[model samples]
Target: MTQQSAAATPMSKEMQDCVQACMACHSICEETMSSCLRMGGQAPAQIMGALMDCADITRMCADMMMRRSPLAAEMCAMCARACDLCAEACAAMPDDAQMTRCAEACHRCAESCRAMASAMM
Candidate 1:
């Protein structure tokens, strides 16, 4: 398809919501990572890794959706998985407010991305 045509095509509501969720999740992951760093040795390596992965994937997924990339659906699927993992990691630290907030964002993003991926299929 031509770039013009692709640009002219409007995104479905689901895709838009997924993009927003991904962006939100990305922001929260970054914030959570900062919070974890301030905690020093309290945060585990695994949780940090999960937060990093989620932050990167969520940003990329949102970009893909915004650009209407042909691989957006695949990215959404991957994003959902990443979000789920991140959420689980964050949930492990339930006592931390930042972690809890990040977990909630990840959960919402995961749900939105899952819906978008399935709808695209």
Candidate 2:
């Protein structure tokens, strides 16, 4: 394919970073959610809900980016909001190592997604 062809077009650095961040956030949220569930009474419904929401959104955003969907930008914006909420929930439990890690991942993912969304606009 020629340089100007669609197939020859590479993803911008921000988009690539957002995609990677989304995938990482998905994995972290899933793991954190499972961990919270395993903790039984330690995990509250709100935290669990946030984790689940973050996991699902991140997975969808990553998939959309991978497919080069036209709606990926919107999806990234949604993912950023979800990630921020999830990070806040996780960060509330400061003593837990898993929660802390999940919060950090979520925050980074949110930043990356925000950048991607702005770039796509």
Candidate 3:
């Protein structure tokens, strides 16, 4: 509750990993969204929506961790789900390099966030 207590509590490795993953996912999703749009035909409404959602959630999850919010765990959980959805959407276009990279990042972030959420529980 107090800043002292919060500061005294060291961050766990899993939490740190999740934070890093979320940040990375955020950047990837954002860049991928633009890249997808530029690619034209491949950027369907569903895929675009997934990229945007993934970017938003990853940013939220990272911010929650940085601020040491009590809701960080819940945010991580939500982020994991979003990342999974994004991964699925990206993976649908196996031939596209950008989509493949985004899918991989999403998968990594999803796994890390899932671990972080479980640890919080």
Candidate 4:
């Protein structure tokens, strides 16, 4: 088959960076969730919800982009929103080192996802 006929296209640098950011965000979210759970009643339910949503969305977004799915752009947009919410939630507990780190990761991922979504438009 000719190169043009292949199902997959090469990923641009922006997409690659976004994918990396998504994966990183996913990892941090997972870690933060565990930390929250270990903190007993210290972490609020809202924060836990945001972390869960961000983790799931970021993982799915990265997978979609890596596979060059037609819906990858939409996924990225959703991922960005999730990341933003997660970041805001994490920022609520500035005293916690894990929360601070997770917030930073979420912010970076959100920025990258936003850029990727715009570029795909």
Candidate 5:
């Protein structure tokens, strides 16, 4: 396995980091939802919601993969799309640095989820 792939394998360094990243993103999105509301008024609702959902699903996907569940791959695939959408939503607003951070986190989670899904299949 290439260093990259091997690192992300279940218990490897990549997986651990990916899990932490996913968790952080999830927490940030959740925490930022209310803050985004205060910051952006009603403008950030859709994107913030998407980000929250994406973070949640991404975390779940990672957990499932860690357990070697039969549905892990499918969950990860779905999460990849969700994270991609979240990134796009966040990208729509470049002015918000927090959204940018959320976007980057979602992108990283999506990449790792995609790899995990592929490996499962």
Candidate 6:
């Protein structure tokens, strides 16, 4: 699409990308948490809980964007911050490739969300 056409649109590529990442992160985190649970004591319960929280928030943020909710910008900002912290926590557990991937995904999603939120400002 041409710049003019795209510009006229409310959502930009960055916003779309962020939403996609947020969705992916949500699914991945849920899956990862399940896997961790299956591992029983091997998984950190507190960390898992935090991951679930982050994923839920991330998904909520994406949902707001999909509906073009009035609170989308605020939600995105909050999700971005949550994602960043979650990513950092995941990064600490380098032993699990899933965690690492989730961390990276969250980080990327956070950046995109933040950018989109900034655009709305």
Which predicted model would earn the best TM-score?
Answer: 1
Per-residue lDDT for 53-108 in model 5, tens only?
88678678767656656676788788878888888898888887877887887788
Residues 1-121, candidate 3: write the lDDT tens digits: 8856875687778878888999899999899888877777468889999999999999999888877788888998999999999999999989988899999999999999998888877
Candidate 6 pairs with clashing backbones: none
Model 4 lDDT at residue 68? 74
Report how far off residue 57 is in candidate 6 (Å). 0.8
| TM-score attained by model 2 | 0.90
Ranking by TM-score: 1, 4, 3, 2, 6, 5
RMSD vs true structure, all candidates: 1.1, 2.9, 1.5, 2.4, 5.6, 4.7
Taking all chains together, each candidate's TM-score versus the true structure is 0.95, 0.90, 0.92, 0.92, 0.78, 0.85
Tell me the number of clashing residue pairs for each predicted model: 0, 0, 0, 0, 0, 0
Q: Which candidate wins on lDDT?
A: 1
Give the per-residue lDDT digits (tens) of candidate 2, residues 1-121: 3424633577778778888999999999999988887888487788999999999999999988876777888999999999999999999899999999999999999999998888877
lDDT of 5: 0.74
Error of 6 at 12 (Å): 2.8
- Model 1 compared with the native: what TM-score? 0.95
Instruction: Give the Cα error of residue 8 in candidate 3, in Å.
Output: 5.2
Model 6, 1-121: lDDT tens digits are 5645544668767778888988998987787788787878476666687688888998899888876776888998998888888888788789999888888888888888899889867
Candidate 1 lDDT over residue span 27-103, tens digit each: 99999888877778578999999999999999999999888888888999999999999999999999988999999
Worst 10 residues of 6 by lDDT: 1-10
lDDT of 2 at 85: 98
Worst 10 residues of 1 by lDDT: 2-11
After TM-score superposition, the amount by which residue 38's alpha carbon in candidate 2 deviates from its true location, in angstroms, is 1.6
